[model samples]
Target: MKKITPANLVPLLTAALPEKDMAHILNALVQFLRDGGVKRASQRFDLLLDAFKQNPELAREFGTRFHRWLGSIHIYPALVGLGIFSRSGFAREMGIRIYERFMPSFKDLNNLRDVFLYLFQRQNDEKWLHTVSLLQWLSLYDTLCRHSDPAAVQTASRHLEQARLHALEMLSIWVAAEELEPEFTRLEPKLMEVDSAFVALHQEISRLVAHYRSGQTEHYDTAHIAVMMEQCRAQVERLRRKGTGAGAGSSVKVAHLLERLSQTLDRLAVLLDIQTAPDEKECRRHCVRLLNSLTTAAVEQHSTELLRRRSINMLAKSISENTSGHGEHYITRNKREYFAMLASAAGGGVIIALMAGNKIRITGLGLGDFTTAFLAGLNYGIGFMFIHIVGCTVATKQPAMTAARIAEHVEHKAGARALESKLAKLLIDVARSQAVAVFGNVVVAVIVASVVAAAVAAHTGAPMLDAHTAAYQFKSLQPFTQPTLWYAAIAGVWLFCSGIISGFYDNRADYLNLRKRLTVQPLLKRLLPARPRAFLADYLHRHYGSLAGNFIFGMLLGMTGWFGHLLGLPLDIRHVAFSSANLGYAAVSDHSGFLYFLLNLAFVLMIGAVNLVVSFSLALTVALRSRGARIESLSKLIDTLWLQIKANPLSLLFPVQPPAAAGGNGNGGNGSSANGKAKE
Candidate 1:
């Protein structure tokens, strides 16, 4: 294998270039090297060096001619006040050098583009990639705009316009071809609609042109005309990716269409007066934006490229899909299911009480703060995992999951009125489910903690929580005077984050076939009996995301307070069920008055509300954004919710009984009742 060097390209460059221009090119090269500074110049020096070596006589002649244009090469004049040594200044200087010497005429630029096209065909060579990148062309254009004369700008614009024209011709030919009938069949209606709109726009433009010619330009609607043109442009773009497998004729036709569309859009942009903006920088910004939109429409229509462009949205959508099962479980459609949710939540509340009591012990251990946090994290994580494995529901975890389901419903529902009505009913279902879960968790957690406290005091001859500890617990649960509610919101944020993580991992598991891979692991075979190994793999396949989410949620709650202490900020998590349990322990230990106990309990409920609301709001926002669903204004949502409440007064608080079975021709029909029972 031979080592590649700059000198190896000398013969190629010499063969490609005109001998008469070699002296001017060499002189410009020396100036470019001097003015552009060593670092950037060094990167391109090898290419210039190789080309110079092609004709020694030309290089010698260029050396004598170099001084004549040395001053012209310094396009960036030093201005201390304006900061001469900047990116724009450097681009300007480089642009002028290339303009005056390397491409002194339009023919030279055309030759360069042709060479680029030829080299691009052989792009397997790594160097070609660098040469063909759009950044280089864009930089040259920017430099010409900054430092070159009107003639230079006209030359560049003419090239772009020519390219634009070619794309149009190609597209028109492709659309009119007989072989394109199948693809065009699907697109014909949309094309007709867009074309009609364009025809109308043309008529309007004709009138505007006449009005301008008659010296009555003030009557013209430029903004409206711009908007119509924009709509037409968008319609054209939507068709760009409709078909595949282009023959030579079709390829040429499609290429023409693309060029024509570009030219049309550019003409409209110029008419919009983007080039004549009051500020040059603002004009450039608009120009860039217009160019970018055109370029994106030209190239990004392929189905495969859409994935690369919208990767984040797709990832989020995948996560939301994973949470659908959990979300559906939160909406109880009958009395039986409603009670089941309550029972599940109550069971989860009992586990929470146990975890809270254990956490107090872990914190009381004379361990350092982080060590204690770590232990607490493990305790909470394992406790939550047990709750999940046992099929119990945590009241707070439902919001993040359910939000995605609601967003999905919003997307699939047909009309605005139908969607509104369905969305209203969904809110009723959500509200009832949330009300029952909160009731279950807070009531059961407090009762369980009170019983446990009483039992411990009776046996140990000491209160479950000592006086100082009880006071601290009471203080932490206080919402208004203390920062507890803020901590509750922090917990809500963590809940949102944990949901995202769960969805992310679930998507990863599906995408990467994690369970399939796990089943084949040698460690599983070595560590377990056959049946147990099979069970473990199957269980992990189904439950891995749920377990991981709960464990991480627990860890976040456990570490937050300790993290806060370290930062000297009042950062902590106030989970509703845990706070209620703590309140019960405090009340029992401190022997608080009824009023004070009631106030603390109220605060606990308020904290839970904040947790649920914050988490649900964030999750819904993400879910809707991922699905490209527009969220309604708050007032409209509230109004719809109120209408739903008025329409079905009892549905949001209690399950509605199924309607009576129809008596058609006296035939016995129990279908509705059976369906209702099935739902339960």
Candidate 2:
């Protein structure tokens, strides 16, 4: 038989608990051991459970100790206030953190939470606390209740009555707040009467709790209250469905509030169930679920996960959804669409080449680092802005936007097979579109830079780049010898940031009703005719986010080198399209041999690979996480991709033409193409 041992989490069961405070308890914990080492949470639980099964004497002592601690502290707050009804935002929590940093909140034993926290104040407490299953917790709870002192059990039950009342109060407050929120009001203009149901439930539950507390033995009619709860939940569900629709009114705060409302409703249901249960068995089941929930709340309270749980996913969904509409346009579907992408990319290449040349002229001005950076930023920013105005594609900008589009597809809750098939096809199209776009940008950028370099040389009677500068450019391309990949990764991160910035601005426009405001402006009404005013407002409304994104992205890229110089750090950006243009200038000016230039071109492509991999990975992660979807079977998706690649290479590269004209299977996707744009 296994030897009996106390659970690592068998809190307040030792000599330390009766005599010591939290600080002293913490000091004593270091001396606690199992197998001459710290036991894992699961192992410790199994050990304690074994002791309960085999050693009744030790079990009784543990149960008594547990009840003693519980009876001493108010257990209601842990049930009512934990992990439910966070109507307040993160700023309030941040203020609390700041206040706690200077002056802590755990000084007084406010409730059972304080005692629980004080008892298990070790760093690894939450690790074991969270990982333990409901059954384990239930088994322990059942045993403790059975073996605990009758007086202590009676005392704990009284505290539980206060917890029930508080839970009802929280439910009522949340329902009231939801009714007042503009976001929910917009979803249900008629006001779905949830607050009334919650109020009724609150009153009914309060009466039932009182009846139990007053030692009434009559059967309480809670059936009406349960029905009210169902109706309220249905109304909440309807609002949630409306919220998820592809509309303009949705925001992160709304999503968070909706999530919180749903959680509070469920939590209140559990509390209600514990009281109105038809039998002891039913009551125990409800009690077990409540215990598990409080465990989760306790674990999260001690970890950074509480903040993460509050808002990160909601913010991600907002950002991803905002970018998805624009991201769709940045893909090519057919030969016509591919050529259109190429054309747009070529236009971007021309502008980038001119921008690079202007940078050379700007560098020669002998300005300070800050001035150079500022002027260069304007040069790049204005050039990128022009590219956007002209509907041109900068290949490096594709990853950030395209990744968001891919995430939109992944956001579905369809069957895994269907999702995998849909995603695989979309991925192939995105890859094909990206490939041609990059080809157009790199090849055309190199050509334009070469022509401009030769023109400068012919006019000035010298190469545009001096021999010394050309040499430095050459060295910068060698990945093995220099940090070219690192710089490319920095560029990728900036690209992702630009996508997020674009999404954020778009969300702001929607939230602020910027388009509507612009149309109704007092100045515009007097200065311009309605037709022109409407057109101007409409155009800016649709395009403002992208334009802002491009300008900021350009500024980021342009100012990086100057920042590196000023900070004495090795920081810079290396975009694939821009770097290709630089390589072209170096080749033409330095009069380098073909083989060495070709080698450098290969290295530039490697830099492009790093850029795509990093940016796409980051964007994809954010996109997937935002939607709460997991691509569970990677091997299956990889297999599907392989099959597609093997079946029709052309389908993966070019759009599949109609079967009648192409004399082939109808497997290739001939979907409608979105006219591609990106620096655009």
Candidate 3:
């Protein structure tokens, strides 16, 4: 038989191989490239490049087919590995198909880097290069997915997706290896030495791998793993530059070692939670795309990568932590929890009623504008804190935290219709929880305000508010007459902000090790006994976010009126509980008729609706955006919501059954039935 060489084999495969066996033939070609040694492989790769140079159509078919094969398998695994799965059958099958396709070829090729190098040298065209680079990336990914650590899978998937995007933008250039060689020659050989450097790097990486295999990963330095990998990568970079133009055949062993080193580094990076430079990954991706081209297809894949960059991972994780009921009991999961939520709201209403009556009386004392805001904020903040300490729920404050939880679910479950149904179930739980809380708040607020107003009247021989004050308070609650609804929405926005503040502080508590820091505080230890100081430290760590969120929310509400006065805008908050209490006071001060009293009561309910709806919508929007989730099919979601409502309308008003068990499939809506609460 004639000795196989690139010049004849390239033509023979194109002219003779059946189209049905393309993937098999490609696998064979990869094997042949691996076995042929560097000199022969380089010669064959160059001959194939010439063939592509001579026949553009043939080049396009090769590029297109190669691109199809590489991309065909990886989409599902990539998405699944990145935690971007819909968790549907489709996603699972995609991952399985990718695994099935790649696993069979794994043992046949010992060094994928050499195969990539062979392809990279002939990479003068974008289409061909894009295909080959994707194949190279898939090989690395396939190896990593069988591991135990989640970090490796996440990092690799993210890197691959980013690389694809970078390739599209940066690989469009006409890069000629012939032109690059002169530039390559100028770089120092000592720095570019592949043989010795790769061996050293390989041995170092193998040691780390051996440690992990032996369950001695604890001895590894996690922080410097990425740095070490980059240094090893530099060796592969030098050989990649030399290609066949200088002495490619001599570096086959280096390529083989480099592959092993790269794989080991990938596992170690995940084990240590060490991050790689995204910029470097992008550069590598562009290089691979160019290498795959080898003067073939020029088609550029559009950048479909989501803007949900890994930079937001920290922020998202914080929000997710707060939303998941992590020892805080915030999500409403069962029937017992639901009743507890209502009871808490009722308690909050009593506190809110007193706060409202006090704020009106204090503001009427003719204190300076700034002083009024400061005093009012103090009253509201302390009162809100009191309610929280007593385990009471504030109706509007639930959305911000719950939105994060819901968004997390959406991330794991992706299809539009599926997401819509999931949201509907969550919405049912949310709606019912809010309904009960609002019911509790409004009823108690009205009752408490009435009692407080009468008590003030008996003591001071005057109602809590004058006629002017009474009229203004009533108008504030009336949705149709003034900008009350808009102001309510503004208050809703503030509620959403408070949720973010709570989540931020919660995350900060963990990140800064607040309890540990507090425990060691010199003043705390010096002034207090060990046991007392430890107790105080633990308390602060657990309740700091709640204290902060409530205080800030109070300040926001109080300052809004003052800011509106300063700007001559009619801006003011209309919290449902507070507004309902105000309605009771206004009714008594004005001695309004029965009909007028009923109308005011109706207005208070409307105000509560505005407050809850606006706040929840804003919070959910932010939560979804933070996770890079955009549900484009609002109609479908609406339809699903309607179907759910139709199926169980009572669920929107009241949970028909007990909430699921704690940590069950509960909505995590209003949180647990625990005695403590986080409130706005």
Each candidate's clash count: 12, 1, 22
Q: Candidates' lDDT values, in order?
A: 0.61, 0.73, 0.58
- List candidate 3 segments past 4 Å from native: 1-287, 290-310, 324-333, 415-422, 630-637, 658-680
TM-score of each: 0.57, 0.82, 0.57
Give Cα distance to truth, residue 15, candidate 3, Å.
39
Please give the lDDT score at residue 502 for candidate 3: 71
By lDDT, the candidates rank as: 2, 1, 3
List ranges where model 2 is wrong by over 4 Å.
Answer: 1-76, 98-102, 106-110, 130-159, 186-256, 413-415, 418-420, 454-482, 520-531, 584-600, 657-673, 676-680
Better of 1 and 3 by lDDT: 1
Please name the candidate that would achieve the greatest TM-score relative to the true structure.
2
lDDT (Cα, tens digit) per residue for candidate 1, span 530-568: 777777776776666778888898899889989999999
lDDT by residue (558-637, candidate 3, tens digit) is: 89999999999888888888888998888877888989988888887877777777767877777677656666677987
Candidate 1 vs candidate 2, TM-score winner: 2
Q: Could you give me the TM-score of model 1 versus the true structure?
A: 0.57
